[model samples]
Target chain A: MLFTIAWRNIWRNKRRTLIVLSSVVVGVVALIMNDSLSIGMIRQMFENQLGSHVAHMQIHKRGFNDNKVIQSVVPDQKRVEEALRSTPEVKYFSRRVVTFGLVSSAINSSGAAIIGVEPDREPNITIIKKSIIEGRYLSGASHEVVIGKKMADKLSVGIGDKIVGMASTVSGAVGSDMFRVVGIFRTVSSEFDKSYVFISLGNAQEMLELGKDVSEFAIILRDRGLVEMVKSKIAARLGANYEVLSYADLMPLILAQMQMYKESMFIVYIIIGLALIFGIINATLMSVFERMQEFGVLMAIGMKNSRLFYMIMLEALVIGVLGTVVGMVVGLAMYLPLSAYGIDLSMFSESLTSFGVGSTIYPVLTLQSIVGILIVIPVFAVLGALYPALKAIRLEPVSAIRYV
Target chain B: MNIIEIKDVEKTYHDNGVPVHALRGVTMTVERGEFLVIAGPSGSGKTTLLNVLGALDTPTKGKVYLEGEDLSTKSRNEIASIRLHKLGFVFQAYNLIPVLSALENIEFTMMLRGIPEKERHERAMALMEELDIAELADKRPNEMSGGQQQRVAVARAMVNDPSIILADEPTANLDTKTGANLLDLMQRMNEEKNLTFVFSSHDPQVI
Candidate 1:
């Protein structure tokens, strides 16, 4: 009976009820848009890292990651290559002999991380081949190199210029090589661009005197979701000499960034919840004060105070539910088409790349987030109505009836 | 058996900074199945006395007993329960919940009592017919006349089969003929069901 009464009573002042409902709808829409944008940006950042530099998984010597020394080269390169070939999920893999060296041009010299990669297989695993701005990809072991555009600018060297790379060999001898810059590439991350220079694997091994040994195998997968499964399979096939690690293990900073985003989202939820509570309280309080005499008469005629409180709360609940359903419908209406087409931030691509995000992003709406909105709205509505309902019950029947 | 007992009940109200006495140590008793009228002019404490008798207001001093139980010793919730099950009221303004239809207004008390819907509807319809307001059952208070809304209010009070009905100026907004007819209906119900009715009115015409 109170349900029926409350449902009808809320419509007594249609303008007031609509005001409260509008605030709720607006709040929910803002929450949905904010959530979608955050999720989209985070997903883009992870994808850029995985597609450009960090493939789904990597294989290296046991202590290679902690200390990048030439002595920690993989012991059995042939057996690891065979395991990777047998794994169906491994789309492409490249052998790499990486070392920190100084690359000096005629006019400038700077420290750089030199990655000696198999030129033919490296193109299938990383985006560096597509990101080349000027000149062609390296074809053979003719001392041809591909350096980042930022590194090229720092060296004041263009395509076809010869740069000398000096590094220490595994045998404790200083080895120096001169390579022609065949390609200059620009990546999404400026940090990555300023630091890496790649060369042919055979030439790198000959110069560094590490014959037939590479430091790591960067493996790209057909499905990113199957990364763990494929990593386990490769680990089982190879012996304890090889270490297989997923992208998450290889880059802990990205995971930490994701965790920080999640914490900030929780704070946003609390702030939105507080705003909704105030909206509901103000509207319900006005209604309560207007019905002061009516409540007095209700109590005088044997209506229980608890029942009156329940009726007021029921009114708030009805408004909360009605507003939430409408907000979700409207929000999804705006979200579905945009999710299909995606939001393009290409105009600000430079700024986005600095943050390590792709130019285009697709907004994702998860079931957990949708359920969170549903649970939060009505709970806040009840909280907002509590003080006003208490005041209604405390009304003195005799004095309230006489109130002018 | 005495249905109500008041022993030297006194009530005071604060007006701005001054205390005004509304009830000055008054005492009264009424037997069961009796109809009583409390008559006084404005500011003469008739409404205050009725409010104390109905347990709507507590006295500053002394005690009020309903059915041999001291109401002053009871908690607020206990008083509310007593009012729900044992007492009914009709206010001067014909205080029908504006949103509810006439039949729903009459059914309100029975609904609070947790009566089955079927039983509540039947009792409400029977009472509406007896009061000759059966056709107004579906009409809201705003759609009905003053006399019809009061009929619905009176029917609501009696639907729970309360032990006593306290009416504060029940005919204050009605015409002379309508007030007389309403009084006649109450007298017939009182005689037929042996129910108690107490009304407070300042009008000599109603008396």
Candidate 2:
């Protein structure tokens, strides 16, 4: 009977009820959209780094990540190859000889990281082949090189143009070689694009004065979920001389930024919830004041004060649940199509590239966020009804009956 | 037998910081099975006296006893319990909960007392039939005339079979014919059930 009464009472002033309901609905939709966009941006940034060069994990000489010097080459290369071939989780791997050097064309010169990659294996691990904008991938021919578009612009070189690469060798001698630019690639990260140049592994080994030695082995796994297990397995097999680093270990800054974004979203939820609380309070207080005499008659007829309080709270709950359910339906209606086709942010591509995100982003909504919305909105609505419920209970029957 | 007793009950309350004495040294007794009226003009303390008798307000001085229980000594919840189990009330406005149908209004008090649904429905229907409002069972207060709404209110009060019914100007909002008919209905109930009634009114017809 209390439920029946409460449900009916809300409709007594339909316009007021709808005003409160609409505010709650708007708050819920805003929360859902905001959460989805943040998640999408973070996910895009993480995937961009992985596809561009990081892969699932990497194996390097213990100190190669800290100092890109020519001497810190991987130890026991034969043992590393045997372990990688034996591990079923290893889908594909690329051996690279990496060194910081200067590349110069006839017109200009710029600093670059010279990465020597196996033409056949490198394309399977990184997005360099797909990101090529102007030329073909390297064909393992002697003196063939693939340079980023940004680096090519700085060096004033294009495909088939000759450039000189100079770096320090393991023997402490200056190693210089002339190579033809076979490709010009552009990745999501402008910084990565401006600093990297790739050449065949054999050509790099010959130029750098290293015999069958590579700086790092970038590995792509059959299943990304097995990154930690495979990293531990590889680390144990290669012993203490080699370091196995997962994507998370290779990109701590991006991970920290993602975590910070999640925390900030909590503040957004609180702001929306607080706004909803005030809206509900205002509506409930008006309803309570309007029905003062009716409440008096209820008290006079022996309705318990606690029952009256519950009735008011129940009305607010109905409004909240109704609004939240509608909002979720509307939010999902918008999210599904956006997730499928993605939201084009090409207008901000330059800024997005700086953050390692592509022009288009696909928003994602998790079950956890859905559960959070369901719990939070109704709880706030009930909290908003608290003061008005107390006011109703505090009325003296005689005075309330006489209330105009 | 005295169903209610009031001894020098005085009700003084503040109206904008000015203490207005609505009742002063008033003493009265109501017998069982009596149809009694506290007749007075406006501002004559008639409603205040009725409020005290109904356990809706506390007196500033003296005591009000209902069936030998001192209402002034009881706590708020205790007073509410007393009102639930022993008293019924009808306001001049016919205060049927506007959201409820006529039948729901009649069953409301019984529902509050935790009566079984089947029994509450049976009693409310029987009373609605007795009051000649069976056809209007599904109608809301807004759909009903003033006389019909008051009949539903009276039926609501009587559904719990309270020991006494306190009415504050029950016929003040009705036409003469309707007020006379309502009085006749109350007289019939009083004679048939031997139920005690207390009324506060300035109406000559009620007097």
Each candidate structure's TM-score, on Cα atoms with residue i matched to residue i, is 0.91, 0.95
lDDT of 2 at B80: 86
Estimate, for each residue in B83-118, the C-alpha lDDT of model 1 and write its tens digit. Answer: 989898888899899999999999988888889999
Q: What is the lDDT of residue A382 in candidate 2?
A: 93
lDDT for B72 in candidate 1 is: 91
For all the predictions, what are the DockQ values?
0.75, 0.84
User: Please, what is the whole-model Cα lDDT of each candidate in the order they appear?
Assistant: 0.87, 0.91
Please report, as a residue range, the 10-residue window in candidate 2 chain B with the lowest summed lDDT.
B197-206
Candidate 2, superposed: residue stretches over 4 Å from native: none
Whose TM-score is greatest here?
2
lDDT of 1 by residue, A1-404 (tens): 88889998999999999999988888777778778877878877777777677788999988788889987898898899899888888898999998988999999998988889898998888889998999988897589989988899999999999999988899988888999999999877666777889899998898899998999999999898899899889988886877899998887888888789778888898898799899999999999988888888888877778888999999999998888888889888988887899888899877777787756767877776788888888788888899999988888877667656
Model 2 lDDT, residue A73, Cα: 92
- What is the lDDT for A242 in model 1? 78
